[model samples]
Target: MKYSRLSIWNIVVKCCMSWVILLQACNNSNEAIEFVSESYGEAEIISIDPKKDIDEEYSMKASLIVSSIDYFPLTLPGDMVIGEVAKMIHHNGYVYIFDRHTESIFIFTGKGEFINAIQRKGGGPEEYRDIKDFEVDRSSGNVLIYSPRSQKILHFAITGEFLGAINNKVQHTSFFPISDYKIAIYNSRLSNGHVFERTFPIQPRFIIANEAEEIEKQDLETAYREQLLMYPNSSFGFYQVGDSLRLMESINSVVYGVDLEEGRVYQRFAFDFTSANPPRLYDMEADELSTFVEDYKNKKVGGWASLHRVNETADLLHATYFYDKQVCRIFYSKNNKSQVNIGASWMNDMDNIPMPLVETTTNEGELLGYYGSDMLSMIVKHGKSKPSQRILDLEKSQRDAESIILVKFRLKDF
Candidate 1:
């Protein structure tokens, strides 16, 4: 298969230069309001410093208090094993697990009883060749699956009944339903052709489309195409909290909160990296950018950024960044103006017993995380000589189970 051998370094430099010129034009035209950051209120900046040891000053009480750990013994009828769950959605007393390996969506009750698998993969009518993404409509109880190969959105009921399909004119990577009549679509890569070629220079990263028309669009400050090409897997992060949709660029420190109803940036959360502020694409010269990229490749300076979870009620944000071959978590508290740098020791905790919930899967109101079945099996076999009653019970129950365990946590009210 032939691939585009375009040098990423050259593309980044060109995109950055183009972005600077576009910003200047927008600033002069009095149209910067559409792109400029609006204030909800200044967020208390929390700076997490890198350290070899867990600094006592930064270490405070664990932000999340584990409420309960539940295990769902998946009771699939046949030889179907729950493959690696790529995405999970806990909605309306049911857990929706999207398994990418099998290209199937499996539904289970809140208590872990197998309900049914959604329509199978096929090329027939109402069937999908591939499911790029999916969203559950709580109001209508419909599961909307986006198939890139077919370029259509397949709608189905919770019970696996096919409803219909919506023709997707715009090849969006993912979508979120804002209302019954509207959706917010995200496109990370620029399409090829004359229309897209002409508009590619100023195309927005996201679009708000109704049943009939596109109502609004917003462009990002960073070079979207360059970043998408550089870090294909970890380019953008999207989280929905209540009525607000949060968007964050993996290479940037700011998290923008957009109003779901209006589809505009309403608030922003900035992280104080202090001396370690990442090199902005628009600010670095060619030589400087080359050195920066080289350093990153050699594991010398900056690392890729991933926002793992965000808790609105606790005013807390959890993220991980890799530097010098070590992955560290940034625990930031928005209300108290404090930050913690948790190293591997803290992440692994005492006796190398994995913390109850160190990674998050979804964040609706509180953070929802899980322990994989493989991790549980290892803990059961080699954890401790005298395990706690909870650990013992968890191990015993999961001895014959092939399901992942779930852990829910909420911010501790100080």
Candidate 2:
């Protein structure tokens, strides 16, 4: 006998609730505390201690070295301009960049040669009205585009062939593909009957589904209800480590390892945020929760963990967070058991040469960073120091070019 998706999900939820109750009971027991301490002996606690002065500079160990800087060719046929990049992925010797402004995916060679754009945008069949997010299925060499408006996952081959789409019922804000047939969808802004009825607190935020149907869902209702109220736009961070998928809530300190094959959470690592912990909504009354939510929106009460990514070796963890109305980048290394606050001054050896923002990790275990076309134009116009020969040559080759700058680097081991 086979169970339906809904039935399976219900069973899973009941089992999870039982586990939650058991965990809660254990939390109240001394034996549970001892067990937790022993179990998490390898876990590292990171404390955020901001300097008295915001402008205080801390020396970062130059472990990662820039290997090469290359520019994507801007001049394609029909004079297409690669607008602001929404997301970038390097796979199989091809660079896939999704331009938010144009709402199109552009394909390029690893050396930045323009190949072709995916399908054109439309409301017709095999076309997407809006692309909320996208991911490449490397195993099948297919590009999957999520269209929230159409509620579909449009599929296309890397060679620009249009495959059929999977009909999606859930209204997801973002999605990450776990396999060629499976994906994890997240919805932060949930409505119940009305827009401001305050029913979103109980809705499930994460769901796992396959191409043909939904699989299972997880909702940390007690832990996320307050977080959703405080930060309506907060979402989960999805990180891929080999075959395992890790999910981290934007405002929470815990990172959960998701078992894609089993459709359940396998393990969890809770980061210790000593002083910068956000206020919980469950602990506050209605009026107090409202006040705290307002303060949090105004950047007064709580900080948020916006993005998190771990290196391929699993030794270094890089995360971006907001605290005291300032955005901060942090590097925590498990190998060295050290944490470094990478403040506003993120530059390379070249004076005034800012390091490109790391967008994602490549298959080869190198961090891929991008310099937008606008930034490249500004650098060419008003850069104080000498530009790289590659940049100068690219500028000379294509007059009025609007190409993206690519930088690849790996975290230096201390």
Candidate 3:
């Protein structure tokens, strides 16, 4: 029997609707699978710069020590190696030097006289296994110490009394405190079923890591895993600038902004370093290989930036995507304006540059300075040069030179 045209049309429409539903379900399932795979396996690094050599000249200049005109010779525990200063936090006229190797915290008066050591190795309320970083709450006159390995944040009175610990849950492997109540945390994940986690929270925040999916190219996966192990969660880093909190995410080495206030995120920067000269990977699946080819076509291999808070502002520093160059472009936001500038030779080519050494106009276009770096590297790579591991000396010399600068200006009439 022949059906009515209307009836036939209705049947056709129902079939089409069913197909649409099936397609949508499949798409969602694939997404879920991909996400689960992302957690189970790992991605590969098609290319990288194997140059691990620390430039000696750069290290020397970066670690240069000078006589303190005021207080001098901050005393550290004899057991702790007074490695080159990794970071200098000046508050209440005292300089706190965090030594990486010695895992010690040394305090000195602004006049350069040694004060008392802040902490020793203990799990009690007053002690720390390792102090990853420290910052002064200028407004509160409180010292905040972040111990990533211990997963704790300790608040200390200016006189070295432990006031209390910041109570919150976090999963960052590394962290930097931005203020008395704020800190940035870094979390990373690798495929060997090993997770590197550290927590720095005065707020309700969580760091989640998922194992990556297994790719056909083991070498690429190895490289990606290795880099991730060295510094993972580049995209998911959290930074606190004053009262504003910033979360940065990375997708394929491109940087994205996390709208914590809005609970939304989007890509803002891309690093395509590996696009031109793709790295070698053997026997990648067609779909997997296509990603690299597309990256090469887009010239987006090495483009990436990480977030760090400098003097109460979030600075996004990035390297040329996919390129092995030792350069970082910094993006700073201030006075409701954003400025971008290049911090050259921060580690290697830091000499001859005076105070306010590096400056730039950011995406929103503003200028400000307070010299910042992976000072931890200075301690981690100490003794490569012949300079005495005097953190106070290094800090004194740098405080006078190379610190962020401010240039005076006025709007001119055309």
Candidate 4:
């Protein structure tokens, strides 16, 4: 693939990209590969930095991106109480929400009909003691949950029947099924990682493993932190962006594209936060790793940024990040090279009223957000700017209901 390339940069990008590493298998392989990270830094890829823009007010408005809004009021029965929405996934005409507190997955139809809940939280052979993370297998319609406590991946039917479990030797807090053979995992060993985090000084942050649980390959190390706390992030995980599976680091805005076929990982996008990243944890010396955690706890900064979600519509790329101590959402226009920034309440010009946060996104390329009952009531009753009759009718129909209303919207092409 490199030979047919025109420029040297293209050749470098094709075979062993700058940050794209080809690591040897962890246990039984000693085939060394050059870990080159400098040759192709952020200069080659597109940088979506909001600091470059002069406008303090967000350029992106609800009207510019939102073509239409949908309200799916979920009907909850007496047995079901969604304690917390830890993770949500929409697939095959159904919506699955994992409640971490309850250790259960609640299923619902696309149109807001209550279905079933997968509540198998036991120490049996089929049940998982705890769920680290879960992904709905697209090809087979099976629910794959990784339980680090049990060191296994349990498979369950979409309708909540236990199929079986796969023995996993690899240490991962969360995993994304690349194919039947390939799986991309977020390494469990971080500075403040959860239960299964090892005390070893060095640990891989990401790994590619097989169904048998043996490591095929791994990349990036977690040697900077003083692994003492318990903070496991299943957010900013292996999410579908377009046709590719993207992995975004929690501390910074560097996103990687995972190749399912070659078991390769490469940098695809980065947000320029020069003031936030330089001279920090990654650059600390071996001796500094000892006291760095305590120092990091006390040290505060104004320029720090961490990406929360990166999703897109056909024409606009949406990204939400914590920048300079404020939560920001920016929509970058693909056609005009413009950016719209909104801090809260997307300017729902269609309704001539404010809408709640449009944060979560579905795999079908639609934005999924929500509004609690109290807030929605305030918007309808208190806002001086009245909503359009269509939006008013939608809210009025569910006015009496006391539940969180899910807002599913598609961005306009313009």
Candidate 5:
């Protein structure tokens, strides 16, 4: 006895539906993100421009307000004179300063009230010499102070207690703590013209893997092959999280993020460095390159290159490029992490700011020892020009007098 045609058709449909379910399971398995040992291409600045609607007026307005605030004059406790301020860090509701001349660390309230000195020049614990930079551990309340001359990043308690030190032979240009156990270190040198990174084992000893060395370790051939794997034509920056590195870049001036684990670069950002114009290139002689690099590494020339984390998702990112005499630009991320814009500070009033560049070996004719901001600020030595004139006679040639200008900026939606 055979079944009706309609019944046979219904059975066939049920079998087809069962097969579809099995196929869906297989597709999901294949779609899982696979691990690969992909390399990345050499990064270069593609394009950048000042953000629209920003101008000298806005930056001036902001500076005038911040300057007038009733902040205390930073003072050096004890025998220290609090010489020149190398950097001023705002953390834990306080402002920390590093004085180069006195070789001491000064602490102040957020509003600029002089609190106390953290360390002094000595060859023992609780002492420091040639302190280059310092970073605060927001979570553990520990502080990491780097003395480039000493080539060490010393850990200390926020209250001036000494902790262990990490001897990462690599000269740390900068660093950001991702947690109590891990940190991302940015390294660069005048001898080498590239910026690279390394992650340390979060322990106080901070043992670094040899493979996490400089970018030179990566050959050109590897870069070409992995170039496609990189977020299509984007500017990238790195952040640390435990043993992982967060890759950030801009598309059309918009910032994007990627999470990296075990050498894999995760693409998390959506924006790209946006510039319709091609990049501007300049080639200098070997001697000139050496001089420029040395000045930058030794902190002789006044300029700053730093990274900032924008939002909680830790998705947004920005880079601050500070030029001497107060003119600088902020590269900000756009929506969808696809584009970034180079925006100027309209509030700091940096128009007509003087940018002074000098060679240290030939310093007899110059008065300004260095140029930069008050915090992480460079030294301005006595000059040949009279104090009344406020002139910087860089050379006997009698260059015209110009005033130094500084600007401040914050993020805003257009």
Candidate 6:
């Protein structure tokens, strides 16, 4: 069932932002993709009125979705350290973390053991001066690090051995390897002078291009751009469920499923959050932008604009988003067609303990969340419910470490 990396997606300016996605495939694409109507299409919209959903107080138990959990104490030896985790992906029994502070990718085992790192921070022809992001070659298990500093995607073995590099025209950052030949770029707006003047034609948010920098596939439909002179660290991300590669847009409510081997986008989702006072700042003036920012900061607008990360089971679609200028998780039942608000983190009622961390989702049926040892110490000291014996022992072992504790749990088909 090996498929060629036939398409690229979500390529553009990758600067001062963050994105972590582990793309997987099942059998096919399409998650609630239906053409209701052109101009009037609220029929298929999965309306999530946060105020109503949050009040219902739906809770999901840790034991319900997960049969087990593993806490990985991510670490490095001596002066080496995993700085800030810009993006984390758990795939194939390995956890790959892109460290933003050090601009390196650190690899670890599934059970909290250090393996190796994929970093060559230097100014050589085979070296990358800077790494904007990294991705794992699903078909080959190779580590591909995208370096804007040297304009190449350096390939390396899982053992940190340099294999080679691919030349890319993606200048602003945020590009990923779709295959050995194609790359995905997310060029939302003109972020820099080079892209504005020389690189690409005016295109949509997602574009697939070959090494020659020729556009291969792009959606004809477009979105209005915000003129903030800055882009969200993750403009858009691609996630995989079963055999489907799904997309969760960073700025809007629509989600898509893509068949990369065929180079077509399956419009998988469209959510109507009008009940949540979503922002409307398209073509807004500077003064208008300032007003919107201040109002949002003062809690005047609903916090349902950006769709960050999403994971899905057969019964539920889970995601995280910018909620009132903070991160919060939202669960939508496919059958119910409405949002199910499960506290800041999973309520963990089944475990009868509070997980004091915000988590992200993956279509791979995994929940990824992280907390430093300091917070773990606090949770053990003054938490309401009793944590599992495993957590308490972890807190004892990592009492004075400079690394993060990654919470990895498998999800069930709710």
In order, how many clashes per candidate?
Answer: 0, 0, 43, 5, 46, 17
Error at 348, model 5, angstroms: 6.2
Model 5 Cα lDDT, one tens digit per residue, 40-153: 233333233322333444344433322321112333333444435444445445555555545556666544456776664566655556676667675664677766665556
User: lDDT tens string, model 1, 1-414?
Assistant: 121222323222221211111110111121111122223355444555443445543232342333333444556655565555666676766777776667778887766788888856899887999988888886675788889888677888888999877766676656877665677776655452332455554465566777664445554422333433443233244555554567654445556776665565533776545444444543455465555445444445433233333434336677654433334555666666565665532322212234443333333445555555555556657664454567567767766655566655454432
Q: Tell me the lDDT of candidate 3.
A: 0.36
Off by over 4 Å in 4: 1-60, 169-173, 179-182, 188-200, 221-224, 227-234, 274-280, 289-292, 300-302, 313-316, 334-337, 359-364, 381-384, 388-400
lDDT of 2 by residue, 31-94 (tens): 1111112233333455565433432243222334334444455435545666566677777677
Cα error, residue 286 of model 4, in Å, equals 3.3
Give the TM-score of each candidate.
0.74, 0.74, 0.42, 0.76, 0.44, 0.75
**lDDT by residue (tens digit), candidate 3, 317-399:** 32321113223233323232333333323332123222221222222212222222223123324424333344335554544
Backbone clashes in model 1, listed as residue pairs: none
Q: After superposition, how far is residue 350 of candidate 2 from its true place, in Å?
A: 4.2
**Alpha-carbon shift of residue 217 in model 4 (angstroms):** 1.9
Backbone-clash count (model 4): 5
lDDT of candidate 4 over 122-185, digit per residue (tens) = 9999888888788888777678888878878888888888877777766555688766666788
Off by over 4 Å in 2: 1-44, 52-75, 178-181, 192-201, 210-235, 266-273, 281-287, 297-315, 350-352, 387-399
In order, candidate lDDTs are 0.54, 0.56, 0.36, 0.59, 0.34, 0.58
Clashes of 1: 0
Q: Using lDDT as the measure, which candidate wins?
A: 4
Q: Residues 164-255, candidate 6: write the lDDT tens digits.
A: 88787655334556888887765444443343344334335566778676668765334233444333323356655565666665545567
- The residue-level lDDT of candidate 1 at 197 comes to 53
Weakest ten-residue segment in model 5 by summed lDDT: 358-367
TM-score, cand. 2 vs. native: 0.74
Best by TM-score: 4
Which scores higher on lDDT, 2 or 5? 2
